[model samples]
Target: MDLRSRIEASYKRIAQEAYDKGYADSIKDIMDLRFGGMPDESLAALREIKDVAVMRSIQNAALSWDRDEVLTLIAQSRSA
Candidate 1:
């Protein structure tokens, strides 16, 4: 690809990573409040998600659902 295209791709990747970290931290904060801490498996699953929109939706869901339901939503999203 051209230099400009390469730079744009790098910037996009950086932005996505930043967004993922922000959302993942939000999810962890909610989990900590609800469960006193989150399970390692759940944290792993959250990190595995690369889509920022999915991460945002999951973070919102985490506020209301129990841990298992949050996990189930992650599992279902992966299958889809």
Candidate 2:
């Protein structure tokens, strides 16, 4: 690739990684407050999720759904 394209690709990758980390941290924060705390395994699994849509959906679900339901979603997301 050209230098410009290489730079753009690097920037995009960095941006996505930052977004994923920030989103994952926020998810943990919300879970801690809403559910008292999350299981360690689930928290680790959540960090492994690269899909922002799935992460956001889990975060949104945690805000309203019961702890059990949210846990189920997290587990499934990790598997996917």
**Top model by lDDT, which number?**
2
Write one digit per residue (lDDT tens) for candidate 1, span 5-67.
999999999998888878888888898888787778778778778876787678777887667
| lDDT of all predictions | 0.80, 0.86
Candidate 1 TM-score, true structure as reference: 0.76
Which sections of candidate 1 miss by over 4 Å?
A: 78-80
lDDT of 2 by residue, 1-80 (tens): 99999999999999999999998899888888877889999989988999878887888888785678778888898777
Over 4 Å off, model 2: none
